[model samples]
Target chain A: MPGNPAVPVAGNRFCIVGGASLVGSATAGELLDHGAAEVVLFDNFAFGSDAAIAHLKDHPRLRLVRGDVMRMANLLRATEGMAGVLQLAAYMTLSMDRDPWGGLDVNIRGVQNALEACRANKVQKVVFASSNAVYGYGPGVSGDLVEGTPFHSVGAPPAAILYGASKIIGEQLCRDAFRKWGQDYVILRYSTVYGERQHYRAANALYIIETYDAVRRGEAPKVFGDGSETKHFVYVGDLARANRMAFESQATDVAVNTSGPAPITTLELVRLVTELAGGGPEPIFVGNEPGKVRLTSGGAFRIAHEEAFRAIGWTPEVDMKEGLRRLIAWRESNEGRAAA
Target chain B: MPGNPAVPVAGNRFCIVGGASLVGSATAGELLDHGAAEVVLFDNFAFGSDAAIAHLKDHPRLRLVRGDVMRMANLLRATEGMAGVLQLAAYMTLSMDRDPWGGLDVNIRGVQNALEACRANKVQKVVFASSNAVYGYGPGVSGDLVEGTPFHSVGAPPAAILYGASKIIGEQLCRDAFRKWGQDYVILRYSTVYGERQHYRAANALYIIETYDAVRRGEAPKVFGDGSETKHFVYVGDLARANRMAFESQATDVAVNTSGPAPITTLELVRLVTELAGGGPEPIFVGNEPGKVRLTSGGAFRIAHEEAFRAIGWTPEVDMKEGLRRLIAWRESNEGRAAA
Candidate 1:
């Protein structure tokens, strides 16, 4: 609390680790628009893509650096002279299910390497991107999920639990750094992100794209279960603003949820997507996919974001309907289609 | 279920990774006593000490192999020709708090290397020594803690969370191996272990030793809080048998709790230790240790071991009173003093 924890965006250099993805690119743009002196996009491009970041690749203030978080040397080089560091590199449940070894390396060790580099270079503040997956998936995961919710993994798959536990570890690693070296940091637990520049990665967000694709192909969108399942998502742009605010604000050594304006049922989500894609046939109810990692909660749950308002003076601005409109419009655009 | 999952003890070879400490030495003795063809004690002696295994060092059937779990070649060579491998190498909360780098490498990477070696060496069965710490610590941790209990980590120290998360990862890694290949394994989520050959390492069990030592020096045993915090612990010998039966059973791709007959409050535990050590002054109520990683629960919680009985056909036989008696008697002996 003593040495001015807030590192303002204007006239300051910031680095976005894993900076080619949806949240990363949007956050890079947000920082740049706020008159940041320089914004370094550091990524190994393992999961990041050129098309996702192509729009700002040539921006004057944005510089792209190819680096892997697995290597300390790469991070040490990438974080040099950075006022703030945004750690957005991680493997979601689907990717973790496929390759846990690489996922663990990136999610666990990658965060460690990034934080170590930040500490070594004396970065003023770090904004770590965690997830609601830390609440875990299973029967015990229901009701209002606050920052104090314990992880529930009774019937969840191994990869999902691994992803959640890895995030928990990452958050704790930041806490450890704070206790050890007084490193100022804020952990933003982003829910499933959607909207412009949406990737085909996250298991939860796949419903929107899959539904839109099915509707566009003149087919009925598939709705698994009765679709009463809850899905909380924060718009990528909203999360971008949260990242910028996290650094610009005086909040440090705290974690809070940055969910969207509200939560929506799966049925509502699918219908919203279909309507946004210019109306389609009625949905077809289906059972669970045999091998895919799908997160199922016990009942209706809301990941409240009021803490974000108090902690970082930020609140989500986009609702599902408005967010879906932007997403469908982006999908129809030239860049979004090419990126897809 | 298509093939025999059980790897019987008689006339079988086994490797105990980290088999130089309290549980490791006891387990080695258990396996040898049951007519194992050969037992390899593989350890780097980082946490494993010479005195812990001094009693069994002269046994011809028990071979002491100096190695590190971080080294794949070491694990591979040590596990070769073994029918089963018991992975017991890990850093507890205390050690994890001290050196998180070495701890994370050992806990995460060490387990990975051991499992990889088991797969490479064609080890028939693996009995992974998980802990009740997987249920985690804090306000959310109370009531009956069963095998499927979700992890509760609110208000817990960073090291404790890291330790618990690492074990969760370890258990999931075993499940992942089982799904990827047919790696038959049983994960025994052992609670705070105490009995003969008890080390001064574990946070919870430290009270027992500290109490006994205090009694020996004519001082009062110190108790934290109102001394009603619940502590469920498994006797080491019973855990040793549980490990043996875990390999010898048909259980595979399963995890269960291996707690004691019941839980004891801090005051009761201190009183029991005092009585067992031939009576002493009343326990001194003390405040929480400032920088210590003492695991205090929200309320009294009992880690149920019913699932372990169903999975491995084993249950806690030695009650805490009896287990502490043996521990106190050992403390009065030459071997225990030398080990201490």
Candidate 2:
């Protein structure tokens, strides 16, 4: 992390709003790994995990504050004495689509609570985990959905999803927070992230992990849409590193593309998962249905990881194949077996 | 009002989520005027007026639900029998800027409550009163802010005001609600609206009325800015009509502008008010300060009026001059002697 020394060091007090979740926990763990003196887990536990808390319970520096993001007083208590915050608390993917009202409450109101806390605490810098979903399935590469892409929430000529709408709102919240408070924030619009501890039980990720498990069981991995639809999946560890990089960087108004180098089609992913799992199952292709196609993808999730790389000297350490291998192996291990 | 009769009429039981303020009360009044079978007013009365409630207290088909938009249960109860909803409850310009914490709670959380209420109540259509402030002052025709202008919140580059930030969040909530529930919504981004029954004591309109009174008392109306910067002031009456048009037309996935023909610079406005008041004070020009240049002239409002005109054959009956005249006359006849 050879960057401006002005960046707050990890040993300094830090807060993770909604820190009991996979992304927030990962970010907190990364901070602890990099020598943070204090890592406060500020979470309402709404979609949060007790296992995550139990995992970090032994860590002397990590403290968990059971709190809701809709309540400012709770967030304030959680964020007190923290120098910086990593805001990863949001309703994403199928969660919002299935229940938009809940999504609005968690995503929009939750973010607002964190922002208000940030303002009250005068926390120095915040790294907001936005999503590439803000850019709905629109045209081509356009330099890998850079920070300045005109967000067309209305996907193409026809269909759009609630997930995209929620993510767009999330980005706007970040922008507004930054604007109103001059609070330094790093917005990382992550591509689809998959790794151990990922909330695989969620509808969208259920498919991903279910596919992996089925392949392990020598069954065909079920894909809803045609295999041609592509996605950019970055390992969760790499995303965790990106969070650390953002905290250690001084770039203002920074929004980096946190994605893998290559965009792989769903078919390719299925085959790769099978190969990584050591010859378990064949890849199965479902027909091109509207709902499935809309969910899978019509546009590629290619992002230029250069901004993040250059700013934080962060790079993807694990390629998809190796990452998938580790994921499968972990899934077969004790904890993995329990989760399965 | 003539358009496609195929467009469905708003459901019989209509509710205005914040139907006690300027926009909400005005919208409710218009809905009643346009033949809504039943109109329910759901407001917490944080900024609402007892006088406004008293005016509508005796209406045959009107009902009042005294509740806050932040309280989901309250909103749920209020929305129980409503078919369509006009969500107009929000912490407005002055309140948001002064009390940012309260602003986030009321604006963002309140919106979430309304969204949940609408979804739970199975409301047919939700007409949301968004603001043009979502687009901060950009380089264009002062009144040329369009629906598609990249809405970089003023907080982005030049710094967004808390009011602007709140409205941006409100707009996102509306978008999310529409996407999540497949709820039909019409987002009307109104410009500065001035008309009858506007809380003249409210911070925003109070300043305007105070200035008018000062000028009428032969005192110079002080200009905060250079007076060259302009704002598109739409009459509240016109805005009310626009809301009616939105309900009557049944337009979906649309955010139309509701502004007057063009903009009147502060200097020009002061001059007009002087003339209208009959031998009143001259205008005083303050230097170009940071706060003074705050005005948006995006054309979205003009386009919205045109769209409304096309959809409902609606036109703004009162021009700016006439509207100002009406406001001054009303003020003089009723409150002038007492206040003076």
TM-score of each model's chain B: 0.98, 0.85
Give one digit per residue, the lDDT tens place, for model 1 in A168-257.
999999999999899999999999999898889999888899999999999999988899999999999999999999999999999999
Q: Which candidate is the best by DockQ?
A: 1
Residue-by-residue lDDT tens digits, candidate 2, A250-327: 675666778876777778888887777777656777774455324444455566677777766777777788777777
Which window of 10 residues has the lowest lDDT sum in candidate 2 chain A? A152-161
Share of native C-alpha contacts between chains A and B (below 8 angstroms) recovered by candidate 2: 0.06
RMSD of each: 1.2, 5.8
Identify the runs in model 1 with alpha carbons over 4 angstroms from their true place.
Answer: none
Check candidate 1 and list the clashing pairs.
none
Candidate 1 lDDT at B203 equals: 93
lDDT of 1 at B323: 95
Task: Report the lDDT of model 2 for residue B109.
Answer: 72
| Single-chain TM-score of chain A, each candidate | 0.98, 0.89
Fnat (0 to 1) per candidate: 0.72, 0.06
